[model samples]
Target: MPDYGFERIGKRLFAEHLVGGNFGNMSVRDGDAGFFIKKTGAYLDAPGEPVFVPFEGPVPKDASSEYRVHLAVYRTTPYRAIVHAHPPYAVAASLVTDEIRPLDSEGEMFCPTIPVTTGAPGTQGLANAVAEEMRHNKLVIARGHGTFAAGATLDEAFLLTSLAEHACKVIALKKMFLQ
Candidate 1:
């Protein structure tokens, strides 16, 4: 991750509540280093404190467990930034629905559809599953886990993630009214 870009992304995500209390991780590729990620347990509050690890070589054993998901998305998409967040509305939708079809214009623009990835946690198999699901969309819900969003920059990724969360909330509200 470029130092400045990293800082910008961290602040944006933190401000959006996509990342806080060390709950999520974000990364961007830096030259031949592969990607730079936040150090484990690092809160987004201090955007300048993350460590950039080289991805061209072996991943550090202590790397974030979600590293595989981030790497897979980066490799499969044109996205330069990837964000994984445990957003409330998205999480609630994921638990109750296997598929979140586009119910509004924002969903169509940011995510035409949101598929659910299935697999055990912290495994490459899970990453592959997510990559496959993401082939047709910019956002996805990891079943009972969380949400992932990707874009040309971290800000775009964060925007898409926020859009997905808002979409979910709208869908939830609609369902309530229908009942």
Candidate 2:
């Protein structure tokens, strides 16, 4: 379809280790047919060709298991881009707390408090939880799972994901030092 900034976002996510192997997913709304989502099992840092599926039609065989989450966000929110990843530190931090209170200044400003979602990774419950939080904030952490960030553009969504990871690192580091 169109150059939806997937390549750049993929590379950045991979380089930052926000995702590994075939983990995580990214998607962009394509006018009205539906959305262009990374194919199932494709590496987030290099999801070759995108698979565009109609919102009300059958999903392709290669679509991500969490494609439902992407669709839910597009249907309920105005955001056009979504980035889902299991940023190591962010996911780790979520395991210990329901909400990650960003201790760093940037975290405080951009992610004062990152909310966590509970449920199986690719379930509708998980999607609904993430979509609800996304209405108020651009990023959310799926407890013991990963992070889901959305924005008008892929760049904004990617940045929110990165910022969330950085904040998690700060929180983790501080905890380590204090203990």
Candidate whose TM-score is highest: 2
Candidate 2, residue 164: the lDDT equals: 92
lDDT of 1 at 170: 87
Instruction: Tell me the tens digit of each residue's lDDT in model 2 across 1-179.
Output: 67888888999999999999889999999877799989988877664898987899899988888998999888889999999988999999888888988888998988798898787888999888888888888889999999999999999999999999999898778878999
Candidate 2: C-alpha RMSD to true structure equals 1.1
lDDT of 2 at 25: 90
Model 2 TM-score (2 dp): 0.96
Per-residue lDDT over 7-75 for candidate 1, one digit per residue giving the tens place of the 0 to 100 score: 566667667766657777787765544676666676655745555556556777656678888778767
Backbone clashes per model, in order? Answer: 1, 1
Q: What is the lDDT of candidate 2?
A: 0.89
